[model samples]
Target: EAGVTQFPSHSVIEKGQTVTLRCDPISGHDNLYWYRRVMGKEIKFLLHFVKESKQDESGMPNNRFLAERTGGTYSTLKVQPAELEDSGVYFCASNYGQGRAFFGQGTRLTVV
Candidate 1:
């Protein structure tokens, strides 16, 4: 019955640092996704996961990032050697069987 939860609501890291963000969706949801909004731009889809498998990842920016859903429970997005351009608000959402997505407060990443 709880909504999605994302850790570290805000992050500040130096360029080239590695950061991992975690997302825990509602208990019974099977659809999970990561989205981003950069500097006032429109929210962009980053990836989607159906259970433990990545369903769609075309929106992922580059190889510097990695996403995983372990045991089909929680998900994590990791950025290695992060770039300044990666600074943005990262959102996590989930739903049950095609239902409307419930989003977290989002983790604001600042790479300086």
Candidate 2:
């Protein structure tokens, strides 16, 4: 079975533009998370999803960002009006509620 997969490995957009990153986790996993790393800093948790419901999203930077896991199958993170500070590698991970998580090849986002 496939692990986690992220689309459009890289994206470059002008400031105030919008970008959406997608992630498909391994089938049957119930826990999903979105993370970000800016300028080599440690990965910061953005949100967590249990199935199709958002379990936690306090880590999200602001209202300009949105995340969703539809039907508990796949997830998407959208950054509207992208800002320079938002430039970073966005990571997606999933697990069966415990232990090591399976990560996707992060989507590198750059806002010019």
Candidate 3:
């Protein structure tokens, strides 16, 4: 089974542009998570989805970012009016129940 897949491995956009990042987790995995490392800071957890519902989203920066997992199949993270401070590598991970998470190659976003 494929672990996890992320689209548009890299994105370069002007400030204020909108960018969407997608993540497809391993089949049958009910625990999905989103994480990121910004400006050499610790890789922080953005959110976690148990199936289609968001279980934890304490690390989300603000309202400009949104994340969704439709029907518990896949997830998408959208950033509206992207800012220079948002440039970083966004990572997605998944697990079956309580085991370790399997991470996808991150999507690098550069806001100019």
Candidate 4:
């Protein structure tokens, strides 16, 4: 099966603009996840999905962000009114092993 896929690969936008990132998990895999790293901090978990339902979203930062998995085949993470602090690498990963899995080439978001 194909591995996780992320689009754009990188993005640069001014503050207050909106950006959406996409991720497509491997076929037949029901587990997907999102993660991000800001500046030099350790990468942090953003959310997880199982089929079409979000299994865990405790890692979500705030209301300015939204994540959804339509039909459980692909997922999207939107950051509206992007902030300078939001500049970082966003990663998508998925697999059925119930642990750490394959990761897509992250989308690097730079806010000016």
Instruction: Say which candidate scores most in lDDT.
Output: 1
- lDDT per residue, candidate 2, 10-102, as tens digits? 999999999999999989999999999998699999999999999999999999999999899999999998999999999999999786899
lDDT of each: 0.97, 0.94, 0.95, 0.92
Top candidate (TM-score): 1
Per-model TM-score on C-alpha atoms: 0.98, 0.96, 0.97, 0.95
Candidate 3's C-alpha runs over 4 A off are none
| TM-score, structure 4 vs. true | 0.95
| Candidates by lDDT, descending order | 1, 3, 2, 4
In terms of lDDT, model 1 sits at 0.97
lDDT of 4 by residue, 1-112 (tens): 6789998799999999999999998887889999999988999999999988989999999988999999999999999989999999999999875756899989999999
Pairs clashing within candidate 4? none
Q: What C-alpha lDDT does candidate 4 achieve relative to the native structure?
A: 0.92
For model 1, state the Cα shift of residue 63 in Å: 0.3
Report residue 14 deviation for candidate 1 (angstroms): 0.3
Candidate 2 lDDT at 81 equals 84
Candidate 2 segments whose C-alpha is farther than 4 A from its true place: none
